[model samples]
Target: MNLLLLKLTLIPTIVALVTLAIRKWGGKIGGLIGSMPWVAGAILLFFILEQGKAFGIQSIQGSMTGIMALITFCLSYAIFARKFTWLPTLLIAYVLYTLTAVVFDYLRLNLMLSYVLVLSYVVLTLYLFPSPTAPPADGRRLPFDIPIRMGVATLFVLIITGLAHVLGPNWSGILTPFPILTSVLAIFSHTLQGSNAAIVTLRGLVMGLLGFTTFLYLQAHWLPEFSVATSFGMAVVINAFINVVVGKIW
Candidate 1:
């Protein structure tokens, strides 16, 4: 791993471990180690954003890499968190690796009205799910959520970017991104933070992404052929997964 990822992954581990140890030992040890994750995550978050200008991130490739790092680093802690279970976390990681490979393509797209529309829908849909009760980095949302929201916004941008990149300029119609089946899992990830939701979201995203993408691939579909109706249909499938995966069908 590079220096940034090292910081992003290691610091959080150190902090969480130190904090927990202090409870058993003393506060001093906890104070030192516990400071690492938050401070590291914050600093690293800024650094990742900064890389955009360091080498002229105006390019899609850089932006895509940046987005990959943004989401990857944010979700890194989940690697150690109890939320992940089953074989699919590995699957999502692999698929995400594939998605990461396309970041450059994602970066190339123009941020047009279509971009705004997709993002608005993702955010709105995410809102419908809401976050589940859990310790919110000290029992409340804070500056911490800034990066989280920023990362998700980047995803919205990505979804839009991905959509526009796949479809051409003249062919405008309601088309979903990869697959709507995974959309609810994205929402569930936002709201719930437990072994159950964690397991479902992780596995569901993988299953859903695979299922939806496979179907799209079979259609021999490219960007221009995608329409808005297809997008909605995909989203419905994603929600169907959420229903089974999270018992949120109602």
Candidate 2:
């Protein structure tokens, strides 16, 4: 119960802060930060605390597979953003995400293989995605925007974590990176700043996933041997280093 309350409070707070940071730094930096394991890391932490390291490892593997879905989501959104408004674009992208998730769920691959596949897809999508042609405009801020985002993020954490028990580690892992935060950010950016802004945001997200992939890779390899504190600490350090490299390259 105490942990549950902590999750409900902590995750949204982090998200709100990140969202504000995005507003301050602009989409590329914000998207890169947003791409960190904020949501999935939190979920896996709770999985370790409640279900044990074995469960966490299994979920991590599942999450690797799930990255394919995230790639699909980004690609779909980027493509459709060219021709459609945010609403229809989001709807269509979501449909693609769902289908991709289902397909990836049934077709399991080893972690290294999954990583290779996902990384390859990311590269292809990045190449194929059209540059945003829309003129830049400042996004309109609603007083309620941050609050709504906070509420929705918190709610998603609750629901996704609760469902993990029923879905088991693999399916839960696949669901871990469901693009909730990305969806919110993309929608708001599209509405306010235009399609190009949203495209930049998604591109940043894909780049940031390099750090995310490293975090999970370390956790999967190290968590079984080390204490959770030690394993997670090392993973964060490595992930931060990789993010720095990515930031430099980007």
Candidate 3:
């Protein structure tokens, strides 16, 4: 298989499918599904395959930091969405996300500490996330919505992977959780459906971060001791299981 071709097509396909699912199931479930490690998972696999498993494992610590930044992005977006439109809300959230990422990268926390701190933060954020007053309104669908999403998301991965050499494993990992997908969903929802819809979607994305964090943490441990296939497969299952449990309770 051509790894490059897979890299180009896989994320868009996943994003397309996730978009369709969101349309079908509504914001929360769609956001949860979107929150899965679709982008980061693929990026890490490529790192392991091209760079080395050791590099991939080392990058997971950075990914933990990325996850924290992601949480801030979603939480801030939800908060700002209450008063502002998508553009301003996204800008504010992005600034906060970048600040969090930079500070955490400087701290250079270990995998275990990053993992614990991220999980603890996820719990606290979930408790604090805004609840939609009502379900999302069914606004008219945007033309080429899914295609645009797929393009933007695939572009982010391509640019990041293209620059992985320059950025190195730690920076690449730190960027793995950047809010491309989250922004797309939030902007569309905020524009078409309204602020509450975006809030619901972002909150659900944060909820999925619980499992997303676990997946990255597990890969750091398992990738060192197991084959890439076996390690990723186990992480996928565990991530799904964690999301399932969290979904049922939250």
lDDT scores of the candidates, listed in order: 0.33, 0.84, 0.88
Best by TM-score: 3
For candidate 3, list the clashing residue pairs, or say none. none
Q: Which stretches of candidate 3 lie over 4 Å from their true place?
A: none
Candidate 3 residues 1-250, lDDT tens each?
8878997789899889988888998888898899898888998988877788888887888899999999999999999998998899989999999999999999988889888999999999999998888778887788898899899989988888888888898998998888878888889899989988998889889889989999998887788789989988998898889888888888
Q: Per-residue lDDT for 131-245 in model 1, tens only?
A: 3344322222234443443344334433433343344321111122321212222333334434334332333232222222222222222222444245335544653453344
Report clash pairs, candidate 2: none
The CA-based lDDT of model 2 is what? 0.84
Q: Give the residue spans of candidate 2 off by over 4 A.
A: none
Ranking by TM-score: 3, 2, 1
TM-score of 3: 0.97
